[model samples]
Target: MKSRRPKIVVIGGGTGLPVILSNLRDQDVDITAVVTVADDGGSSGIIRHYVNVVPPGDIRNVMVALAEIPGIYKDLFQYRFETTDDFFAGHAIGNLIIAALSEMKGGIFDAVQELSQLMRVNGHIYPAANEPLELHAQFADGTTLRGEAEITAAHKLIKRVWVETSNHHAQPRAAQPVIDAIMDADQIVLGPGSLFTSILPNLMISSVGKAVRESPAEVVYICNIMTQKGETENFTDADHVRVLNEHLGANFIDTVLVNTGKVPDKYIDYQRWDEMSQPVKHDFQGLRSQGCRVISTDFLQLRDNGAFHNGQEVVHELLNLIGQPRFQKDSRG
Candidate 1:
């Protein structure tokens, strides 16, 4: 009998998730992306304010990443209007498409699944929640901020983060399909995105967090290459893992992918990419203390004077891990 494809669930938002998904699409595996809906920035924020739907910018990009359609179709979907356009200015065509579909379908979850079939997406794209979620962060200075944009712009060290409904009455929850995806996953991956804003917002969802903690899959974290000025300035790799563990109230991460590459400082254009501070410092001992197996290597790709993971390299490692004896034993048992 033919074996079932390995089911991999990637959880996070921002640019990193799509980059990794686009590469994983080429491999023979079942991919499910659990995207964060806590965005309140740029086009997404604008749409959220007016349309009152889960931000579609991240979901739209994830669609393109896993889409098995023509390049022209993808291009048309991703096309963004110029700021000069008054009515629909600064919004991607895909975002508007998702918004329209959400309204037609009466919810974001159903709309994404419908669009996923239309786009011929290789796998599933599940929003971390059905409704729009507000990200609330408490800074180390004892001040609290609401909205993902406000929290990141505060540039203060974050103490912790949680999500709430727009009215702050109901607790946010994931769709049953999302929880089932986590429960059935052969491997689960988190972040190559913002530590607090991009990654945590999804996990902070009570159901999603509980499912992740209790899931049997080997949890992997693709540690960021550079520390962000607002989110993780002067942060070590271990610090990132610690924050994740503390928020979930469990030391659950099983493996961490760290970049041991040297980034040339002068190559970074501070003027353009001001959000990034520097390379994430490594602490092998701290990672071990958290009960994580560290995979350190040269996973860097330098382009546009910015540091990023070479997605092919990262996916190669992921496939290798899935084939290992330990993973086979854990997954089969």
Candidate 2:
């Protein structure tokens, strides 16, 4: 008889989440990705304006990452129309499908579930919220930016960030499944994405934040290899965990994955990897101060002139975290 697969719930958005999920699929684990809905740029932003649904770009990418199909069909789902088609230009076929399903199902949560089946996704994919969410950032100088694109484009030092409805009044919400996934998971992972915009937006949701704080699951944060332009200009690995703890109002992260690999002085091309400034500085002592067990490894890969965590190596570390005292959750579903 087969045993149950260890369940892992990854909470974040952006390109990073998919890399980790794609790698984790090789392991005997159940995966659930909680993607950020704070996107308001490019195809996602334009679609959100038209349909009033959570931007599908991040969710779509995650779906493709976890999809268990041939490369040709995956390419079809990701295909974008040429600029010659004025209206559909730059929109991914997968993005359009997600929007249509959202409208048909009356919410992004249901749309993703139905789409996940068709995609033959190995695990669940859920948007962080039910409705559209806007990202708001307060920079070091105390000025504020309204949207994800605007904040990243500003190239300013971000002091803090949070997410709420576009109107800025009522609190944002996470679907019941999102919270349940977190609370019942054997381990919860965060990161390898934007600190403020990508990871924090999902945590900033009221119930999601509270559940993360209260969940018995071991929370492992995979720190980024390079610093983002505006989000994490000169941050250390420990600084990343500090910001997440501050935003969530608790030191909940149990383990942090730090890349010990060094990038050559001029290794990164400024134009190709424009958003990143430099390698993320590491402060092992600082991480110790925060009660986090730092797992440093040569988990770095330079791709397309950008520094990224070695996805396969990162997933190995995550699997190791399971069954350990620190990562062991006391409760069962």
Candidate 3:
């Protein structure tokens, strides 16, 4: 009999979670994706506003990431309506499927599970909350922003982010499985995704944060390759770690993965000058001082269209970290 594969839990939302999952699925690890549900833009926003369901963008991405179907099924699900008309324009087919299922099951979580079974996903995916909740941000300048879309457009420095309801309850199903996965996991990975929007949103949930802080699994963070324009305009690798620690509390992560490769000057120029984005400067020494073991490597993958990390190079690096003796050593020392 083959040996049992290690159980892995990835926590985040949007494009990043799916990218990570797509790679991990190939490695035969038992994977569980805990997705953020605070999205309030485009098709997801319309559904949430009208029918009152959890945002489905992140969940849809995870489904596509874990999809075992071949040919048109994948293509069809990912297809988007392109039109100038407001009714159907910009809507994704998968988003509609999730909405339909939610209506049938009368709950988004149950609907997601049902769809996961149908998609023949390698593992599981879940929303961070059951009830649709808005994300609220308090800026440093004393301005408060409501809704995820509005917060992103604030174009100002964010002091902190929280759920709209002070008494908001966690979807019991979401918290229980995630806690169980964390407790039994060999490794727990954070992100190579958006810092504030993707990663921190999940961590801000009270139950999720409590479970992560108490789990024995080695928590690894894959720092982003570039700074997001609106969110992390000038953040460095150390700055990213600092904000995460601040939000999740001290000593949250055990290891940090930083990209050490040279980005092509053309790509850098296109991103910086053209896109108004900047490369994330690696601060290895600064990160090490925070009681986390630092692992640096050339983890960049150039795509056909000149995109970076087109595949799962970052995910492989994360798996390699889990096997290292240094990662096994307790950070509390």
Candidate 4:
């Protein structure tokens, strides 16, 4: 009998998720991305306003990352209209396609699956919820705000976050396939994105959170290289993990990948990457206190005057973890 490949489920949204997913596609693992549905910004926010479907920017990017199609088609799908293009200005071709497909298919979840197969995606892309979700946050200063954009722009420390429908009443839930993916995974990776907005929104869902907390997989967190101005300003690596643990009400993270690389002072262009504040401080004892195995190394890549994770290096470490005794035993059964 042939041996089954490792099942790795990555949960998060924003630009960071795709960086990791794109690299993981080259590996010999069954990948599933559980994307957050709480985005209310950019072309996605615009589409969400006019359409009743979940935002497609993150889903669209994830699809392209795992897609096995030709470069020209991918480029065509990602093409965005110029500002002078009238009503189509600033809209990515893929975002519009996802919205149109969602309308035809009756849901974003099914639309993504259909598009995934059509695009020849190597793995699964599951939205955290079927419907569009709004992210709500309570700041450390005791103020409240709704919408991911508003929360991030508030520049205040977030106390808690949760998701709700457009009506702002009903609870959000993940589909069974998402839950099954989480429950049966050999490894579950989180972040390289905003701690509160991108990652926590998916976990805020009741069923998704419950499944993650109960899953036997080794939950790894790809901690961001730098702190974000409005989100994680002056945050240490441990602070990031603490926020995640607090929101879930458990120290569920099994391992954390920390970047020890130093970015040159002259390299970062604050004007272009205004959201980035400073390098994340290291707190080895603090991370160990939270019951997380810390893998601190130089996982940095500087490009376009911004700092990002070297996806190739991160994916290599992720694949290495799959061979551990615990993950090996779980995969066999």
Candidate 5:
């Protein structure tokens, strides 16, 4: 089965990357999760600052998602330290482990590979860059900002965003494995996460973007169900595609999976979903105008009072996209 399974490269970060990968785990497909390493918030930020490594938050989550380990181990890995513990306050067990391993290996990429084996990860989990990456965004108003945390808090319309080394170096490089995975994949998936900080940061890496643009794989964009407040405010699905195409300088996306289900007018809890405000406005015509074959479906599920993509449904569609028709053998002899 492993020899015959279609190889897929799922690219993106934030909470959304895990959802699709967790669902795709049991399928007859080989998965390689290329996660973003640009996060500068919460436990990840603290650990990165002290340890001098890329923030491990997103990579840690991707690891848990792809891991086929014991239930207790998963729980223990996700457990957060209490605020009373001043030294370890708010740090997740896995985040700390990733930080330690990065220090042990002297880089993030090798550290992730080591953990993947220890965790029994069903597929590869690679950080977008082996070093800390600082995200810089230029607003549509000509103003510029740095850091993923800063950009999220800016609440301004962004024109374009790119990645730079945390030490302020202009060049950002993705690992060779990352580039090789995209170039060798049968399908390359983008998104189901923050459009600017999550998905775009990885693509902003010069080499990774080039590989995706040049790869013959079927590129798919999984459009988010809701619009983020400061990030994608009142943005349409086409707006998402437009930014991606502009960044890569080509209409590389071959297909887009869009959620057509109606989110009840008063469905979202403003208190909880403070980041994302409303359902992403659909512009099917515009999506088609971009030369993308759009597959519309009800890929919505409400959990923890927040709206999320129906992982199973999305994974089913992915399997279908790569599934070749089987021919029955004639047994007349």
Candidate 6:
């Protein structure tokens, strides 16, 4: 008889979640993606504004990543409108489908599940909340920004972020599954995404934070290769963990994976001159002092199109971490 595969819950939203999920799909692990619902841009924004639905872009990305469908279906789902019109341009077909399903099912979570089934997704994808959420950011300069778009475009240092409504609640339907997944999970992985916006937002959910703090699963954090321009302008690995622990409380993460290789000079020059983004400095000692172990490796693999991370290399590192003897030990220590 074969041993059962480990259950894993990946928490984040947007491009990063899908990349991680896509790499893990063929592995012997059961995956659950808990996506942040604070997105208010493009097609997602349109649907949220018009119908009061949680933006489905991240969930749609995960769905496509985990989908076992053929090439044609994948291409069709990923197709976006290329017109110059303000009404329909830049809208994703999958986003519209998910929005329509949410309208039919009366909520975004149900719509996601319905779409997952239709797409033949190998695992589950859930929104962090049922109600539409506005992402509000308090900048270091005492300036406040509302909505995801404005926050991303602020170009200022963000002090903190929170949901708009005090009465905002995690979709109990979404929380229950997350809790269940955590209880059954052997490991939980956080990011390779934006530290403040993508990764931290999910952990900010009251129920989700409680579940993570109390879960018995070992938590792994994949630190970003480069600092994001507006979000993590000058953030180091230690800074990332510090903010995460501050938001989710102390002793939240177990292991942090850092990229150890030197970035190509050409890319570094391009980033400095073109993108104006800096490299994320890894401070292993700083992270270790905060009760988390550091795992360093050459995890960066940039493509011709400027995309980073060779999927197989990341999967190899993740699998190595999972197979470690330390991984079986108590994460609380």
Residue 192 in model 1: shift from native, Å? 0.7
Shift in Å, residue 138, candidate 4 = 0.3
User: Can you give the TM-score per candidate against the true fold?
Assistant: 0.97, 0.95, 0.91, 0.97, 0.95, 0.91
Write the residue-wise lDDT of candidate 4 on 232-271 in tens digits: 9999999999999888888888889999999998899999
1-333 per-residue lDDT for model 3 (tens digits): 978888888998756678788989888688988888888888889877787888887888889889899858988888888988578798889988998899999878889989999989898786776656667788889999888788877788888887654245543234477677777888888876777778887777777877777787888888877677667888888888888888877767788878877677766545433323666887777787777888787877655323345346687777776667654434543
Q: Tens-digit lDDT track for model 6 on 116-202?
A: 888899988878777677788899999998888889887899888876542445433344787777667778889878777788778
Question: Candidate 6: misplaced stretches above 4 Å?
Answer: 84-87, 165-174, 268-276, 305-307, 327-333
True-vs-predicted CA distance for residue 95, candidate 4, Å: 0.5
Task: Choose 2 or 4, whichever is better by lDDT.
Answer: 4
lDDT of 2: 0.89
Q: Give one digit per residue, the lDDT tens place, for model 2 in 1-333.
A: 987888999999988999999999878999999999999988999899998889999998999999998999899999988989998999999889999999999999999999889889998888899899988889889899889999999999887888889777889989899999999988989988999889998998989988987888888999999999977888998899989888877778888999999998887998987888888998999887877888999999888766888889999899988878873333211
lDDT of 6 at 280: 85
Q: Please rank every candidate by lDDT, starting with the best.
A: 1, 4, 5, 2, 6, 3
Worst 10 residues of 2 by lDDT: 324-333
Worst 10 residues of 5 by lDDT: 324-333
Q: Write the per-residue lDDT of candidate 1 for residues 1-333, one digit (tens) a residue.
A: 999999999999999999899999989999999999999999999999999999999999999999999999999999999989999899999999999999999999999999999999999999999899999999998999999989888999999999999988899989999999999998999979998999999999999999998888889999999999889999999999999999998888888999988999699988888888999999999998888888999999999988899999999889988866433223221
- Name the runs in model 3 displaced over 4 angstroms: 84-86, 165-173, 268-276, 304-307, 327-330
lDDT of each: 0.93, 0.89, 0.77, 0.92, 0.89, 0.79
Cα shift from native, residue 76, model 2 (Å):
0.7
Our model 3 lands, by Cα RMSD against the true structure, at 2.7
For model 2, name the residue pairs that clash. none
Whole-model lDDT, model 6: 0.79
